[model samples]
Target: MTHLVMDVDTGIDDSLALLYLLGDSRAQLEAIVCTAGNVPARQVADNTLGWLALAGAGAIEVALGAEVPLSQPLQTTEDTHGPLGVGYAELPPHGRTISGRHAASVWSEAARSHPGEVTGLVTGPLTNLALAVQLDPELPQLLGRLVVMGGALNHPGNTRPTVEWNTAVDPDAAKIVFDRFAGLPAERRPILCPLDLTERIVMTSAHVERLAAASGCAAPERILPSDDRGRRSSADVELIRQLSDAIRFYMEFHRDMGQGFIAHMHDPFAAAVALDPGRAQYRPATLDVELAGRLTRGQIVADWPGPSGAGIWGRPPNADVAADTDPEAFFDALIERIAAVALDGPAR
Candidate 1:
């Protein structure tokens, strides 16, 4: 079992990804820390704890990460995930309370305790990770690897033509993490699921339908309400069944927006890859975030001759850029794993 410490922003997708990871008996999820990005760090941490309770994962250690990036202002997509993040869907505001340890301290203690055996999956802004690195200079030395879900290397971004949500939220932190990891030796590799590569993959209608069917509940008259057009995306079928009402609310927005069924599952892709590298195809290249570019700020620079950058993880052109992922294989593995989660009746 791979031990993992996740830093997320508590978006609906983040909740789904955690549900999938913690549900898998094969995955030994050690800790989770919420960062400030799509939502404020405190809210993100609260959401994380709440979702864990919803999924019956209250035993997992949870911490509140930094409320802001080291040097940048925070940004959020309230319009996308909605203000509550769980989409105004009624969920218990109460959950198992986390320790007072901030994200960086929790990370430092974990790195010291584990020493080179723990892997980090960053599904939110890079602030907490950057801060942790600063707090524990030995963090990179003890880390197994870092998998990030941000940047726009070769593909266009959903937030804008050039920038993705995570990177845009904290480009400076992203740059620090990328550059710090770049100087590491071959034994340490940082995997990236930049927007360009992630855009090619989406949660299809079939995927969501599978989860709805597997839900073992009375299927709604229509999961996508007639009035909501955003949820009518081609990717609707991929919804993980046990998510909170906030997630359903976001789905309704998608359905209302006419792309509900086809909503793109972004952050969750990083978790999937961290679970298994073979699930996706990647090419190595020198990937650096351009924090100074006017038109392309927060864009990932992939210096490969081909359409997608090519390079090695520690060589001159280092870091693996996620070029392609086997959508069919990913979907198969996800559903199979979701089936394994034993929920204890409905959420309180």
Candidate 2:
């Protein structure tokens, strides 16, 4: 079994990542640390519990992470994730209580409990993990593996000309994570799924239709770009309905941004890689965050080896940056796995 602890901001994509893990039989999700990103941290906690209730996994502890970043005010993307951060889907209140422990402490505790067995997955801002690492410098070395969904290397930025959303939200934390994790054995380094590759893992209405069909939905779940912006799904299955509704908003947002009528499955893609590294290929590189740049404050700087086969900065590779992946293979597995879990229905 793969022991795991997840840190998320509970956006539409982050919710999908949670579902992916909840559905995957290989993942033993120990806890979920909710951070502020797509929405406020408290809202993130509520969104997470709601999803857990939907999955019938309410027993899993949900911890509230820091409400703000290390050095910047908290920033949320409600326009992208809807007002509640789960897009057009409004999950039924789970009525479950979130853990009283802070997310930083929860991280240290989970790492201590599982030690070399747990793998850390961060799908939102790096704020919580950065806090945990700051308090415990050895925290990075203790986990079996780490996977972060942030950064923009060799691709146009999603948040700005040179930055990704997650990193832009907390560049300091991103820097701390990259700097602290350097010098670890190659296998333990964090596998970063930057935009170059993640953007390719797109979700069109056809994929959603496949997922609904796989989930045994009797009614059609196909969402067309011509549909009303706030149209709610009426699929036979509740999970499938919500997924269609949520992803519709995301797909529309992508289209509005001129990326076509498709949703970029960034967080869930990272979650998939966390479960099966074979889903994507990676290359080790020395990574840094541009904190001082006027227009590149949150840009990720990946130092690839020069043509001479030597590092330009002379620093050892600190991260295994994702270099390639098959989007079709990933979606194929996701639809099957998520279908099984969605078929289980909600908890009573």
Candidate 3:
């Protein structure tokens, strides 16, 4: 089994990523570290616990991380994820409490306990991981891999003209993480699933209809609502209902963006690549975060070699950046994993 420690902001896609991990039989979720990105830190913690309960994954430990970025005030995206971050889905309050320790401490503890067996899947701001790296300099070497779902790479940014939300929210932390990982050996470098690749793993309304149908829930017409309110009642399986409700706002946001009624599976794609690296194609590149420019701040500059087979500006490759993904295969794997969860109930 692939042991994972996920760091999330517990928004729409983050919730989907959590469910995907919980449903995949090969994934052994060691812990979930909630950070501030898509929502507030406390609300992210609450959303994490609620998702755990919905997935019946209460056994997994949950911890709260930084409430604000290392150098900036907290910026939330409630407009995209609704007021509570999980759209219209109203999950019951979890009886289990978050770990008393901070998120960095939780990361250190998990790494020390699991040693080289753990894989860190971060789908939010890099503040927690950066702090964890500071607390334990050996953290990069302790994990088997670090799959991050941020950065725009060769593609345009989703948050600004040149910045993605996660990295833009905390460019300092992003710089720290990239620099630390770049210093590591090539084999130990983190894998980046940026917008260039994640945009390829889009989930349209048709796919949602298929997933809802596969869950043995009511038909799409019965479960999906036309507006943001979503369905008033739950489905046969709680997971299906939660997923359906959670994606409503996300889909609406995509529609508003003129991207159709489809949401990019950014976090979930990162989670998938963490579980199986072969799911997407990758290219080694030297990555650096732009922290100085007012317009380019938080932009990830990937330096690819010239035709002469020499490094660009003498910068050696640092990380493996995802170039593309097989959409059909990715969707198939996602569907199968969710279907397994629906059939077998929440993992553990």
Candidate 4:
């Protein structure tokens, strides 16, 4: 079984990543440290609790992390993730309240308690982890593995012309984590899933239909465009209905952005890579985040023998950058795992 401590922004994609783990029996989610990225920090904690309630995940600890970036004002992507961060889905908060501990404390405590057994997964800005590292400098070596979903490594950016969303949210934190982890051994290096790798894990209306069907919803999940509106999913299962509504908004957003009617499943793909190291073809490189370019700030540079994920400046590679991943394999596991959550089935 894999023991995981997560730091997330609880956006639509982050919600899907959480569901993937909730359904997978092997993933023992130890705690969740919420940060402000997709939405406010407090809202992210509530969203995390709501998902736990929806999935009937045991009383996992949920803690609030950084309320803002290291040195910048907080900026949330409400347009991309909706006001509450779960797209159109309204997940009711459960009886569980936020942990009394701060996110940095929770981070240090979780890893220190578990030692080499904890896999640290950060699906949002690195602010929380960066703060945690400040509290505990040993955090990098303490974590057995780390999987991060951010950056635009040698690719076009999603937030700006040269930056990805998460890194753009807090480039300073990203820089700190990369620099701190640089000293770790290669085997213990974090897996970096930049946009160059994650953009390939796209989700379409058909994949939603398949996921609904796998969860025993017979409704045809279709998203059409015309002077006449398209038919949306009316799946009876609560989980299916919620996900359908959420993904439909995501698809619309992508379509409006001219990326077709698709949502980039970045976070869940990172979750999969965390569970299985070989799920993606990785290239080790020295990775760093740009902090001072007027046009290029927040851009992550991965130096291979020459550019950067897995090295640069005469330093050895500090990250195992995911250069490629099999989309079909990921979708297979995603559908099956999330389907199991809807069914409340035994973890596979």
Candidate of highest lDDT: 2
Residues 57-96, model 4: lDDT tens digits: 7778899989999998889998888778877787765788
lDDT for position 242 in model 1 = 32
Backbone collisions counted per model:
47, 0, 0, 11
Residue 46 displacement (Å), model 3: 0.9
Clash number for candidate 3:
0
The candidates, ranked best first by lDDT, are 2, 4, 3, 1
How does residue 199 of candidate 3 score in lDDT? 86
Error of 3 at 291 (Å): 0.9
Each prediction's TM-score versus the true structure: 0.86, 0.97, 0.95, 0.95
Model 4 lDDT, residue 234, Cα: 67
Candidate scoring better on TM-score of 3 and 4: 4
Ranking by TM-score: 2, 4, 3, 1
The number of the candidate with the highest TM-score is 2
- Over 129-179, each residue of candidate 2 has an lDDT whose tens digit, in order, gives 999998888898789999999999999998899799999999999999989
Considering summed lDDT, which 10 consecutive residues are worst modelled in model 2?
339-348
Better of 3 and 4 by lDDT: 4
Q: Give the TM-score of candidate 1.
A: 0.86
The lDDT of each candidate is 0.70, 0.89, 0.84, 0.87
Clashing pairs in 3: none
In angstroms, the error of model 4 at 221 is 2.8
How close is each model in CA RMSD to the real structure? 4.5, 1.7, 1.9, 2.2
The better-scoring model by TM-score among 2 and 4 is 2
